[model samples]
Target: MLRFILGLVLVVGLWSAAPVAQAQNADIEATISAQLEAFKVDDFDQAFTYASPTIQGLFRTPENFGNMVRGGYPMVWRPSEVTYLELKETAGFLFQRVMITDAEGAVHLLEYQMVQMDGTWKINGVRLLANPPATA
Candidate 1:
């Protein structure tokens, strides 16, 4: 029947798309992990490379960006544990959720806005989720 054929087509399309979505998520996670590793080693220049062009322009220099992270997001700057959560899209923008445990063992939930530039995922910005974390 026509309905059955259309349903089958939809299912097939989604089935093939699953792998592409998974790969994209993996790439996004890798970018975040690399930035965290760079922060661990105090390599601002390396960490800054993962940021989106807009962020780079706003910070203007790696040192400025590093200082901002060190002061404003101490948890991210020196996270003791990092866990990647769900990646969601809202209004055509993708945001990757992450749970980071700071050096003091405090848990912080953050959403990293991700943007793809020239076939690579880059971190556009990060925002801390409010209290009672993970509820976001």
Candidate 2:
């Protein structure tokens, strides 16, 4: 009876947590989508607002952050298409995978590290991942 109760508790706990996780995922995706829209119009100031305090402190200003994106992440800066792939939590951090198709038709996978600050989701960092080799 004790084992059955414990299993029941575990199942209930997981079921209750699903909605919260789903909400978090939706918020994270919205934040990224807003930032990408800003990037599309070269509105760095607006895009910077989605970044976490740590990233803002490191970049120092919107222009600097925009410059970095333009130079180092041109695909993100000017993506022809963007698609959200997955959101996963590891080591207490949430990472969002996004697939971007550049103007030249090359696809790039990027991981955006996200954090919650004052109940709002902010982008903490972004890393470009290497593409898997063709299986042909």
Candidate 3:
């Protein structure tokens, strides 16, 4: 009887948790997820849509931009356990900081400088930081 009750409780818990686990991504998470998904599918055109105007000028072609992201930053190209750490406003624009953990358990801190033009936040640049000490 005790085992039956425990099994029933576990089943009910999992059933109730499904919705939250599958919930829609928040604004910041959605932006990052969109970019990642685009890159994963090799859709540079779709990925470029998220870039700020300044970024567009820096890398005119999708190939150039994708190459920069893939080769220069292999950590970001193949990252796991990505988490949005913070979103802070600077001057009149907003900046987001995302922390990514690689397959080898290395942390890659990325600073996504954002600017809101006409109400939509666009990523202007990505600054990769050196991995902090394990204690950090």
Top-lDDT structure, candidate number: 1
Q: How many residue pairs clash in each candidate?
A: 0, 0, 0
* Each candidate: RMSD: 2.3, 1.7, 9.7
Query: In angstroms, how far off is 40's CA in candidate 1?
Result: 0.5
Q: Please, what is the TM-score per model?
A: 0.93, 0.89, 0.72
Candidate 1 TM-score over all chains jointly = 0.93
How do these models rank on lDDT, best leading?
1, 2, 3
**TM-score head-to-head 1 vs 2, winner:** 1
Residue lDDT tens for model 2, 26-127: 999999999988998999999999999999999999999999999999998889988889899899999999989899988899999999999999999999
Task: Tell me the spans in candidate 2 whose CA falls farther than 4 Å from its real position.
Answer: 1-4, 133-136
Question: What are the lDDT scores of the predictions, listed in order?
Answer: 0.95, 0.94, 0.76
Query: What is the Å distance of residue 2 in model 1 from its true position?
Result: 3.2
- Off by more than 4 A, model 3: 1-25
Deviation in Å, model 3, residue 114 alpha carbon: 1.0
Two-way lDDT contest, 1 vs 2, winner: 1
